[model samples]
Target: MVVSSVEKPIAKQPHASRLYRELAPAYEAVWPILARKRIRAAIGNLELDAGHRLLEVGVGTGMSLDSYPQSIDITGVDLSTEMLAQAQRLVEEERWSNVRLLPMNAEELLFDDSSFDVVTSFHVISVVSDPRRMMREVVRVCKPGGKILIVNHFRSNNSWIARMVDSAGAVTRRLGWRTDLNLHEITADFPLRVERCYKTSPTSLFTILTATKLDA
Candidate 1:
């Protein structure tokens, strides 16, 4: 998308970057328990083969890095360099030769079109300045017939539950993420098909969605 220098200020998430940068270590400590199992399960469901190219958007602290099969090539990118540093240390300590981590914005990925066989993003869509832009980038970089997997909390179809969450949108927005992002709206124009939508557990707020890009 080539975000301009002038627009960069608005594009860069001051509050979100600061919060995640300072708390990168703490995020490593706390987020895994809540997400590891689900992320692993969803990636597992993809049944990725050896040599498949995979890109993970917003790969904070490399939380889901270990879950991906070592046989596949993995590229993980995030806007927070501090978080990337944390993820880098893990990549080094684990000696994951198949994994590469970089600092990049989710909404403006630098790769060429159809660059990867699979794409993933977890708990990150709502944090970007433009969720739909991020999604568009995801679709652009994925190869035809490739796969896309996203795990996030979107506004519920259930009016009562959605209303309760929407009421908190102002607060969450200030805190760095929005609570009222609609999944359908964000995904409607993409050339992807939703194959499955599920939760780690019945009560979990996050939805793990799997989709496939239509063949060229």
Candidate 2:
């Protein structure tokens, strides 16, 4: 008698597979290029040394891959399988052996405590449903004295820019994104101390923050 084999379906994290399947194509197309340049500049200014273990949440299309040192060990997580599929392709096409991709939520991570030397996110907070939980998780997994690097566009405090951001919220939401929250509000939830922040042009829309996770 001959026996047949059965293949198990790959399980996905909740609420993410749909969003990723729908949005992954567009996100993969433009984001990799658009975010690449900005992130490179931001990481360059960070002065990170080689051989660091880094965690990148919402690492769509692996744009930040170029910013990290080749000697570093990097792991990237995203909720979208479609996005991860694209990321995998990018990594393979580029022959990057130091990077690993996993499907995960920023609000919850499966990694052990203090597993990473740096936790970074690029333009992610504005879109996640629970930024506070995500921030806390990021801090939790980072080693003592590790840095959290965030480059994001946020709601403007300026009246005119605030109006524009508010107006854009509806459209952005339909496409599965949240309007940028005030940085001050989110930062208050963490014990982190801001090392530096830079305001990019077209104000009230974009900001870059670098914070160091405090030791317990």
Candidate 3:
């Protein structure tokens, strides 16, 4: 997946919400160029139809809103109020009546089990405080046979590159994400069955991972 260039690490663990809050204003300007193509590739083939309920975790600024079919209902949650506010503005300005934005923690989703037909997170898992908890919550809220999609940068398999990225984790954390998160560890023991995995970005740094939730 798409790894960011290494920069100096910040000394302290910055508050997650605060980091996004500070980045919210500049997010749209910066991320669209870097993330749009990969995100579109990830959600483009979802089997959405009218009445389908979709939940997006860590839906920063709602950049992916336009990619979904208008017939589907969408609920998006993020930890940053500033990001949600921007998302709200985009939803209103674009007149996407089917979308709703809320400030929420991905690790502690408020919805009941099987509440949604689809669950997705774009460029989010690597940034969350607890990726395992976030994935579990995503799985919990999705219906059996539902699709769960994730688009993010995973650590490189190249030993040298992986080592460099892992060594730079302290610096990358300051920018709001880790560079060395292992994809296998993230999906370990999860109930979902892998359906597809492919590189989505031109540089092959970002990947699209799709899975189907199995019956209980």
Candidate 1 structure lDDT: 0.86
Q: Report the number of the highest-lDDT candidate.
A: 1
Residue 182 Cα positional deviation in candidate 3, in Å, after optimal superposition: 1.0
lDDT, residue 203, model 1: 69
Better of 1 and 2 by TM-score: 1
lDDT of each residue in 144-182, candidate 1, tens digit only: 999999999988888988898888888878768888888
How well is each residue in 36-113 modelled by candidate 2, as lDDT tens digits? 767887788776778889999988777788778888889998877778888899899989999988877777777777
The order of the candidates by lDDT, greatest first, is: 1, 3, 2
The lDDT values for all models are 0.86, 0.78, 0.84
What's model 2's TM-score?
0.88
Q: Which stretches of candidate 1 lie over 4 Å from their true place?
A: 1-14
- What's the TM-score of each model vs. the native? 0.90, 0.88, 0.89
| lDDT score, candidate 2, position 211 | 92
Candidate 3: minimum summed lDDT over ten consecutive residues — where? Answer: 1-10
Worst 10 residues of 2 by lDDT: 1-10
